[model samples]
Target chain A: MMDFISYTCLIVGVIFWFWGTIPLLSERSVLFKLHSLSVSDTLGSMSIIFGLLLKIPREWPLLVLAIVCLVLWNTMLGYVLAYCSSSGEKRENR
Target chain B: MVGHLIFRLTIWFLLTANLSWLNILIGLSISLLLPRGYTNPETLKEWLSILGKILWAIPLAYIEAFDLILRPHNDEDMVCEQVEKKRSHRLVFLDILLITFTPKTIVVKYHEEGWYEVHRVTRRKKP
Candidate 1:
Protein backbone atom coordinates (compact mmCIF):
# COMPACT_ATOMS: atom_id res chain seq x y z
CA MET A 1 0.00 0.00 0.00
CA MET A 2 2.76 2.42 0.91
CA ASP A 3 4.67 1.70 -2.27
CA PHE A 4 1.54 2.19 -4.33
CA ILE A 5 0.83 5.52 -2.74
CA SER A 6 4.42 6.68 -3.15
CA TYR A 7 4.49 5.81 -6.82
CA THR A 8 1.15 7.51 -7.33
CA CYS A 9 2.49 10.69 -5.78
CA LEU A 10 5.57 10.59 -7.96
CA ILE A 11 3.49 10.08 -11.07
CA VAL A 12 1.08 12.83 -10.17
CA GLY A 13 3.94 15.17 -9.52
CA VAL A 14 5.35 14.50 -12.96
CA ILE A 15 1.96 15.15 -14.52
CA PHE A 16 1.80 18.45 -12.73
CA TRP A 17 5.27 19.36 -13.96
CA PHE A 18 4.20 18.78 -17.54
CA TRP A 19 0.87 20.50 -17.09
CA GLY A 20 2.57 23.61 -15.83
CA THR A 21 5.31 23.74 -18.42
CA ILE A 22 3.09 23.20 -21.44
CA PRO A 23 1.49 26.62 -20.95
CA LEU A 24 4.79 28.36 -21.40
CA LEU A 25 4.46 27.73 -25.11
CA SER A 26 1.16 29.63 -25.21
CA GLU A 27 1.03 33.28 -26.21
CA ARG A 28 -0.42 34.44 -22.87
CA SER A 29 1.01 37.33 -20.94
CA VAL A 30 4.07 36.68 -18.84
CA LEU A 31 2.17 37.13 -15.59
CA PHE A 32 -0.45 34.61 -16.66
CA LYS A 33 2.14 32.01 -17.50
CA LEU A 34 4.03 32.83 -14.33
CA HIS A 35 0.96 32.32 -12.17
CA SER A 36 0.30 28.85 -13.47
CA LEU A 37 3.95 27.87 -13.61
CA SER A 38 4.82 28.80 -10.07
CA VAL A 39 1.77 27.17 -8.55
CA SER A 40 2.13 23.83 -10.32
CA ASP A 41 5.90 23.72 -10.14
CA THR A 42 5.91 24.29 -6.42
CA LEU A 43 3.17 21.75 -5.89
CA GLY A 44 4.84 19.18 -8.12
CA SER A 45 8.20 19.52 -6.43
CA MET A 46 6.66 19.26 -3.00
CA SER A 47 4.66 16.20 -3.98
CA ILE A 48 7.77 14.53 -5.35
CA ILE A 49 9.73 15.29 -2.21
CA PHE A 50 6.87 14.01 -0.10
CA GLY A 51 6.83 10.75 -2.02
CA LEU A 52 10.55 10.41 -1.41
CA LEU A 53 10.06 11.11 2.28
CA LEU A 54 7.51 8.31 2.51
CA LYS A 55 9.80 5.97 0.58
CA ILE A 56 12.81 6.74 2.76
CA PRO A 57 11.53 7.69 6.16
CA ARG A 58 15.06 7.73 7.53
CA GLU A 59 15.87 10.86 5.54
CA TRP A 60 12.68 12.64 6.55
CA PRO A 61 14.28 15.66 8.09
CA LEU A 62 16.02 16.53 4.88
CA LEU A 63 12.97 15.76 2.79
CA VAL A 64 10.74 17.89 4.97
CA LEU A 65 13.26 20.71 4.77
CA ALA A 66 13.22 20.41 1.01
CA ILE A 67 9.46 20.82 0.96
CA VAL A 68 9.65 23.89 3.16
CA CYS A 69 12.32 25.47 1.03
CA LEU A 70 10.39 24.63 -2.12
CA VAL A 71 7.23 26.33 -0.89
CA LEU A 72 8.89 29.41 0.58
CA TRP A 73 11.51 30.10 -2.03
CA ASN A 74 9.32 29.21 -5.00
CA THR A 75 6.61 31.60 -3.87
CA MET A 76 9.10 34.37 -3.20
CA LEU A 77 10.80 33.80 -6.50
CA GLY A 78 7.48 33.93 -8.32
CA TYR A 79 6.68 37.30 -6.80
CA VAL A 80 10.12 38.64 -7.59
CA LEU A 81 9.96 37.47 -11.18
CA ALA A 82 6.53 38.97 -11.73
CA TYR A 83 7.54 42.25 -10.16
CA CYS A 84 10.72 42.56 -12.21
CA SER A 85 9.10 41.65 -15.50
CA SER A 86 6.19 44.06 -15.11
CA SER A 87 8.35 46.93 -13.88
CA GLY A 88 10.83 46.42 -16.68
CA GLU A 89 8.03 46.54 -19.21
CA LYS A 90 6.84 49.83 -17.77
CA ARG A 91 10.37 51.23 -17.94
CA GLU A 92 10.59 50.29 -21.61
CA ASN A 93 7.34 52.05 -22.36
CA ARG A 94 8.50 55.26 -20.60
CA MET B 1 13.78 38.61 19.08
CA VAL B 2 13.52 35.09 20.44
CA GLY B 3 11.42 34.05 17.47
CA HIS B 4 14.08 35.08 15.00
CA LEU B 5 16.71 33.12 16.87
CA ILE B 6 14.51 30.04 17.03
CA PHE B 7 13.65 30.29 13.33
CA ARG B 8 17.28 30.48 12.31
CA LEU B 9 18.25 27.67 14.65
CA THR B 10 15.50 25.44 13.28
CA ILE B 11 16.74 25.95 9.73
CA TRP B 12 20.30 25.21 10.83
CA PHE B 13 19.30 21.95 12.48
CA LEU B 14 17.23 20.92 9.48
CA LEU B 15 20.07 21.70 7.11
CA THR B 16 22.66 19.82 9.15
CA ALA B 17 20.21 17.02 10.10
CA ASN B 18 22.24 16.17 13.14
CA LEU B 19 21.61 16.11 16.88
CA SER B 20 25.10 15.80 18.25
CA TRP B 21 26.11 18.14 21.05
CA LEU B 22 28.78 19.70 18.85
CA ASN B 23 26.28 20.18 16.04
CA ILE B 24 23.82 21.84 18.36
CA LEU B 25 26.52 24.18 19.65
CA ILE B 26 27.55 25.11 16.15
CA GLY B 27 24.00 25.72 15.04
CA LEU B 28 23.32 27.93 18.03
CA SER B 29 26.44 30.00 17.44
CA ILE B 30 25.77 30.39 13.75
CA SER B 31 22.19 31.49 14.34
CA LEU B 32 23.30 34.07 16.83
CA LEU B 33 26.42 35.22 15.01
CA LEU B 34 24.48 36.07 11.87
CA PRO B 35 23.73 39.75 11.39
CA ARG B 36 20.30 40.51 12.80
CA GLY B 37 17.79 42.57 10.86
CA TYR B 38 15.49 45.19 12.30
CA THR B 39 13.08 43.70 14.80
CA ASN B 40 9.69 42.74 13.46
CA PRO B 41 6.91 44.44 15.36
CA GLU B 42 4.34 41.78 14.49
CA THR B 43 3.27 39.59 17.37
CA LEU B 44 3.82 35.84 17.50
CA LYS B 45 0.10 35.16 17.25
CA GLU B 46 -0.16 37.10 13.99
CA TRP B 47 2.88 35.35 12.61
CA LEU B 48 1.47 31.93 13.46
CA SER B 49 -1.85 32.82 11.86
CA ILE B 50 -0.12 33.92 8.70
CA LEU B 51 1.85 30.69 8.69
CA GLY B 52 -1.32 28.69 9.09
CA LYS B 53 -2.86 30.57 6.20
CA ILE B 54 0.17 29.75 4.09
CA LEU B 55 -0.15 26.08 4.94
CA TRP B 56 -3.81 26.29 4.05
CA ALA B 57 -2.84 27.79 0.70
CA ILE B 58 -1.09 24.59 -0.38
CA PRO B 59 -4.22 22.51 -0.87
CA LEU B 60 -6.02 25.56 -2.17
CA ALA B 61 -3.27 26.05 -4.74
CA TYR B 62 -3.74 22.51 -6.05
CA ILE B 63 -7.44 23.11 -6.53
CA GLU B 64 -6.72 26.33 -8.36
CA ALA B 65 -4.16 24.53 -10.53
CA PHE B 66 -6.71 21.97 -11.61
CA ASP B 67 -9.16 24.76 -12.39
CA LEU B 68 -6.56 26.52 -14.49
CA ILE B 69 -5.73 23.31 -16.33
CA LEU B 70 -9.34 22.50 -17.02
CA ARG B 71 -10.04 25.97 -18.34
CA PRO B 72 -7.02 27.27 -20.17
CA HIS B 73 -8.83 30.19 -21.77
CA ASN B 74 -9.73 32.15 -18.69
CA ASP B 75 -9.85 35.94 -18.95
CA GLU B 76 -7.00 37.90 -17.44
CA ASP B 77 -7.24 41.22 -15.63
CA MET B 78 -4.82 43.58 -13.95
CA VAL B 79 -6.00 45.64 -11.01
CA CYS B 80 -4.55 47.57 -8.10
CA GLU B 81 -5.50 46.46 -4.59
CA GLN B 82 -5.19 48.37 -1.37
CA VAL B 83 -2.68 47.09 1.13
CA GLU B 84 -3.47 46.89 4.78
CA LYS B 85 -2.39 49.88 6.82
CA LYS B 86 0.86 49.93 8.76
CA ARG B 87 1.99 46.56 7.43
CA SER B 88 5.62 45.77 8.11
CA HIS B 89 7.95 44.60 5.40
CA ARG B 90 7.79 41.00 6.60
CA LEU B 91 4.02 41.03 6.60
CA VAL B 92 3.97 42.55 3.14
CA PHE B 93 6.34 39.85 1.98
CA LEU B 94 4.10 37.16 3.37
CA ASP B 95 1.06 38.78 1.76
CA ILE B 96 2.71 38.80 -1.64
CA LEU B 97 3.89 35.24 -1.20
CA LEU B 98 0.47 34.01 -0.25
CA ILE B 99 -1.22 35.80 -3.13
CA THR B 100 1.25 34.64 -5.77
CA PHE B 101 1.35 31.07 -4.51
CA THR B 102 -2.15 30.55 -5.84
CA PRO B 103 -2.48 29.70 -9.54
CA LYS B 104 -4.90 32.39 -10.65
CA THR B 105 -3.29 35.46 -9.16
CA ILE B 106 0.17 37.02 -9.12
CA VAL B 107 1.25 40.30 -7.60
CA VAL B 108 2.87 42.33 -10.34
CA LYS B 109 4.05 45.23 -8.23
CA TYR B 110 3.81 46.71 -4.76
CA HIS B 111 3.40 50.47 -4.92
CA GLU B 112 4.87 52.79 -2.32
CA GLU B 113 1.47 54.15 -1.34
CA GLY B 114 0.21 50.78 -0.04
CA TRP B 115 -1.25 49.29 -3.18
CA TYR B 116 -0.58 46.02 -4.93
CA GLU B 117 -0.88 45.73 -8.68
CA VAL B 118 -2.25 42.21 -9.06
CA HIS B 119 -2.82 40.21 -12.21
CA ARG B 120 -5.63 37.68 -12.04
CA VAL B 121 -6.98 34.95 -14.30
CA THR B 122 -10.75 34.76 -13.95
CA ARG B 123 -13.35 32.48 -15.42
CA ARG B 124 -14.90 33.61 -18.71
CA LYS B 125 -18.50 34.72 -18.66
CA LYS B 126 -21.03 32.77 -20.67
CA PRO B 127 -22.41 34.62 -23.69
Candidate 2:
Protein backbone atom coordinates (compact mmCIF):
# COMPACT_ATOMS: atom_id res chain seq x y z
CA MET A 1 0.00 0.00 0.00
CA MET A 2 2.75 2.41 0.95
CA ASP A 3 4.80 1.59 -2.11
CA PHE A 4 1.76 2.15 -4.28
CA ILE A 5 1.17 5.52 -2.64
CA SER A 6 4.80 6.49 -3.12
CA TYR A 7 4.60 5.66 -6.76
CA THR A 8 1.46 7.71 -7.06
CA CYS A 9 3.06 10.68 -5.34
CA LEU A 10 6.16 10.48 -7.53
CA ILE A 11 4.02 10.46 -10.63
CA VAL A 12 1.97 13.40 -9.41
CA GLY A 13 5.09 15.36 -8.55
CA VAL A 14 6.56 14.70 -11.97
CA ILE A 15 3.35 15.75 -13.67
CA PHE A 16 3.32 19.01 -11.81
CA TRP A 17 7.01 19.52 -12.48
CA PHE A 18 6.28 19.18 -16.15
CA TRP A 19 3.33 21.49 -15.73
CA GLY A 20 5.64 24.00 -14.08
CA THR A 21 7.43 24.33 -17.40
CA ILE A 22 4.45 25.86 -19.16
CA PRO A 23 5.01 29.36 -17.79
CA LEU A 24 8.31 29.59 -19.59
CA LEU A 25 6.65 29.29 -22.99
CA SER A 26 3.61 31.25 -21.92
CA GLU A 27 2.91 34.53 -23.71
CA ARG A 28 0.72 35.64 -20.84
CA SER A 29 1.75 38.08 -18.15
CA VAL A 30 4.68 36.71 -16.19
CA LEU A 31 3.16 37.54 -12.82
CA PHE A 32 0.14 35.41 -13.50
CA LYS A 33 2.19 32.57 -14.89
CA LEU A 34 4.60 32.67 -11.97
CA HIS A 35 1.77 32.39 -9.53
CA SER A 36 0.39 29.42 -11.40
CA LEU A 37 3.70 27.64 -11.59
CA SER A 38 4.39 28.22 -7.92
CA VAL A 39 1.04 26.93 -6.82
CA SER A 40 1.54 23.82 -8.88
CA ASP A 41 5.05 23.28 -7.53
CA THR A 42 4.01 23.75 -3.93
CA LEU A 43 1.04 21.43 -4.26
CA GLY A 44 2.93 18.84 -6.18
CA SER A 45 5.95 18.89 -3.91
CA MET A 46 3.91 18.86 -0.74
CA SER A 47 1.82 15.95 -1.90
CA ILE A 48 4.88 14.00 -2.82
CA ILE A 49 6.57 14.77 0.47
CA PHE A 50 3.51 13.77 2.43
CA GLY A 51 3.40 10.49 0.62
CA LEU A 52 7.05 9.87 1.41
CA LEU A 53 6.61 10.88 5.04
CA LEU A 54 4.18 8.05 5.53
CA LYS A 55 6.83 5.45 4.76
CA ILE A 56 9.55 6.54 7.24
CA PRO A 57 9.47 4.32 10.34
CA ARG A 58 10.11 6.48 13.42
CA GLU A 59 12.30 9.54 12.83
CA TRP A 60 9.71 12.14 13.66
CA PRO A 61 12.09 14.97 14.47
CA LEU A 62 14.06 14.85 11.27
CA LEU A 63 10.96 14.27 9.21
CA VAL A 64 9.30 17.27 10.75
CA LEU A 65 12.35 19.40 10.04
CA ALA A 66 12.55 18.18 6.47
CA ILE A 67 8.90 19.02 5.92
CA VAL A 68 9.30 22.47 7.41
CA CYS A 69 12.35 23.18 5.27
CA LEU A 70 10.62 21.97 2.16
CA VAL A 71 7.70 24.25 2.80
CA LEU A 72 9.99 27.19 3.49
CA TRP A 73 12.11 26.63 0.42
CA ASN A 74 9.20 26.21 -1.94
CA THR A 75 7.30 29.17 -0.54
CA MET A 76 10.36 31.37 -0.78
CA LEU A 77 11.00 30.21 -4.29
CA GLY A 78 7.51 31.33 -5.23
CA TYR A 79 7.94 34.73 -3.63
CA VAL A 80 11.36 35.40 -5.13
CA LEU A 81 10.27 34.28 -8.57
CA ALA A 82 7.33 36.65 -8.41
CA TYR A 83 9.58 39.45 -7.26
CA CYS A 84 12.18 38.88 -9.97
CA SER A 85 9.46 38.78 -12.58
CA SER A 86 7.99 42.02 -11.27
CA SER A 87 11.40 43.66 -11.30
CA GLY A 88 11.77 42.67 -14.93
CA GLU A 89 8.38 44.23 -15.53
CA LYS A 90 9.60 47.54 -14.13
CA ARG A 91 12.57 47.52 -16.49
CA GLU A 92 10.31 46.73 -19.41
CA ASN A 93 7.98 49.55 -18.45
CA ARG A 94 10.88 51.96 -18.35
CA MET B 1 25.82 34.97 -14.26
CA VAL B 2 26.59 35.56 -10.62
CA GLY B 3 22.91 35.61 -9.74
CA HIS B 4 22.37 32.35 -11.59
CA LEU B 5 25.28 30.70 -9.80
CA ILE B 6 23.99 31.82 -6.46
CA PHE B 7 20.58 30.39 -7.16
CA ARG B 8 22.08 27.05 -8.18
CA LEU B 9 24.13 26.81 -5.01
CA THR B 10 21.10 27.51 -2.90
CA ILE B 11 19.32 24.67 -4.61
CA TRP B 12 22.23 22.35 -3.97
CA PHE B 13 22.63 23.30 -0.31
CA LEU B 14 18.93 23.03 0.31
CA LEU B 15 18.95 19.53 -1.08
CA THR B 16 21.95 18.55 0.99
CA ALA B 17 20.40 20.11 4.05
CA ASN B 18 17.45 17.85 3.59
CA LEU B 19 19.84 14.90 3.17
CA SER B 20 18.04 14.11 0.02
CA TRP B 21 19.14 11.59 -2.57
CA LEU B 22 16.86 13.66 -4.72
CA ASN B 23 19.95 15.85 -5.16
CA ILE B 24 21.02 13.95 -8.23
CA LEU B 25 17.59 14.15 -9.77
CA ILE B 26 17.05 17.77 -8.78
CA GLY B 27 20.49 18.67 -10.10
CA LEU B 28 19.66 17.07 -13.37
CA SER B 29 16.36 18.86 -13.53
CA ILE B 30 17.99 22.19 -12.83
CA SER B 31 20.52 21.58 -15.54
CA LEU B 32 17.70 20.99 -17.96
CA LEU B 33 15.87 24.08 -16.82
CA LEU B 34 18.64 26.66 -16.58
CA PRO B 35 21.57 27.60 -18.77
CA ARG B 36 24.62 25.33 -18.80
CA GLY B 37 27.17 27.58 -17.09
CA TYR B 38 25.79 27.37 -13.56
CA THR B 39 25.61 23.59 -13.44
CA ASN B 40 28.75 22.80 -15.40
CA PRO B 41 31.37 24.18 -13.01
CA GLU B 42 34.50 22.11 -13.64
CA THR B 43 36.12 22.22 -10.21
CA LEU B 44 35.50 22.35 -6.47
CA LYS B 45 36.78 25.92 -6.45
CA GLU B 46 34.29 26.86 -9.12
CA TRP B 47 31.41 25.21 -7.23
CA LEU B 48 32.39 26.96 -4.00
CA SER B 49 32.52 30.32 -5.76
CA ILE B 50 29.10 29.74 -7.26
CA LEU B 51 27.69 28.82 -3.84
CA GLY B 52 29.28 31.88 -2.29
CA LYS B 53 27.78 34.07 -4.97
CA ILE B 54 24.35 32.55 -4.40
CA LEU B 55 24.41 33.04 -0.65
CA TRP B 56 25.66 36.60 -0.95
CA ALA B 57 23.41 37.61 -3.79
CA ILE B 58 19.93 36.59 -2.55
CA PRO B 59 19.88 39.02 0.35
CA LEU B 60 21.63 41.78 -1.53
CA ALA B 61 19.11 41.44 -4.30
CA TYR B 62 16.27 41.67 -1.80
CA ILE B 63 17.64 44.82 -0.22
CA GLU B 64 18.19 46.49 -3.58
CA ALA B 65 14.70 45.58 -4.69
CA PHE B 66 13.28 46.77 -1.39
CA ASP B 67 14.98 50.17 -1.72
CA LEU B 68 13.59 50.61 -5.22
CA ILE B 69 10.06 49.85 -4.07
CA LEU B 70 10.30 52.02 -0.98
CA ARG B 71 11.55 55.25 -2.58
CA PRO B 72 9.48 55.37 -5.72
CA HIS B 73 8.87 59.10 -5.45
CA ASN B 74 12.51 60.13 -5.11
CA ASP B 75 13.60 61.58 -8.42
CA GLU B 76 16.73 63.07 -6.89
CA ASP B 77 20.16 61.48 -6.91
CA MET B 78 19.87 58.13 -5.25
CA VAL B 79 23.40 57.87 -4.09
CA CYS B 80 23.98 55.18 -1.50
CA GLU B 81 26.82 53.36 0.26
CA GLN B 82 26.36 49.65 0.21
CA VAL B 83 28.08 46.34 -0.25
CA GLU B 84 29.66 44.87 -3.44
CA LYS B 85 28.10 43.80 -6.72
CA LYS B 86 29.89 41.11 -8.79
CA ARG B 87 33.22 39.82 -10.07
CA SER B 88 34.98 42.18 -12.51
CA HIS B 89 31.87 44.39 -12.40
CA ARG B 90 32.33 47.47 -10.23
CA LEU B 91 28.66 47.94 -9.43
CA VAL B 92 28.90 50.07 -6.33
CA PHE B 93 25.98 49.10 -4.13
CA LEU B 94 24.56 52.53 -4.96
CA ASP B 95 24.47 51.80 -8.71
CA ILE B 96 23.04 48.27 -8.84
CA LEU B 97 20.92 49.54 -5.98
CA LEU B 98 18.88 51.59 -8.44
CA ILE B 99 17.88 48.74 -10.70
CA THR B 100 15.36 47.82 -8.00
CA PHE B 101 14.69 51.25 -6.40
CA THR B 102 15.33 54.88 -7.57
CA PRO B 103 16.27 53.49 -10.96
CA LYS B 104 15.60 56.71 -12.82
CA THR B 105 18.34 58.68 -11.07
CA ILE B 106 20.91 56.09 -12.04
CA VAL B 107 23.72 57.11 -14.31
CA VAL B 108 23.95 53.80 -16.08
CA LYS B 109 27.26 52.73 -17.50
CA TYR B 110 26.38 52.61 -21.12
CA HIS B 111 28.63 50.70 -23.50
CA GLU B 112 28.07 53.18 -26.32
CA GLU B 113 29.99 55.98 -24.56
CA GLY B 114 31.93 53.86 -22.09
CA TRP B 115 30.98 56.38 -19.42
CA TYR B 116 28.59 56.56 -16.55
CA GLU B 117 26.86 59.83 -17.32
CA VAL B 118 24.54 61.52 -14.90
CA HIS B 119 20.95 60.51 -15.35
CA ARG B 120 18.70 63.20 -16.75
CA VAL B 121 16.65 63.27 -13.58
CA THR B 122 19.77 63.56 -11.42
CA ARG B 123 21.13 66.30 -13.67
CA ARG B 124 17.92 68.25 -13.33
CA LYS B 125 18.26 68.16 -9.55
CA LYS B 126 21.87 69.48 -9.62
CA PRO B 127 23.18 72.99 -10.29
lDDT leader: 1
Candidate 2 recovers a fraction of native contacts equal to 0.00
lDDT of 1 at B86: 80
Worst-scoring 10-residue span by lDDT in model 1 chain B:
B65-74
What's the distance in Å from true for residue A56, model 1? Answer: 1.2
Considering chain A alone, what is the TM-score of candidate 2? 0.69
Tens digits of per-residue lDDT, candidate 1, B4-119, equal 78889889888989999999999989888999778559987888999899879989988887777777746788888996678788888889888988878888888878999999
lDDT, model 2, position B80: 38
Docking band of candidate 1? medium
Which model scores highest in DockQ?
1
Give per-model TM-scores.
0.92, 0.37
lDDT tens per residue, model 2, B52-114: 764564345334333433443222332333332232332332233233222123332323323
Candidate 2 regions exceeding 4 Å error are B1-127
Q: Tens digits of per-residue lDDT for model 1 on A1-94?
A: 9998899888888888998888799898888788768756898887888888888899887888888888888988888898898889889999
Model 1 lDDT, residue B70, Cα: 77
Model 2, A50: alpha-carbon shift in Å?
1.7
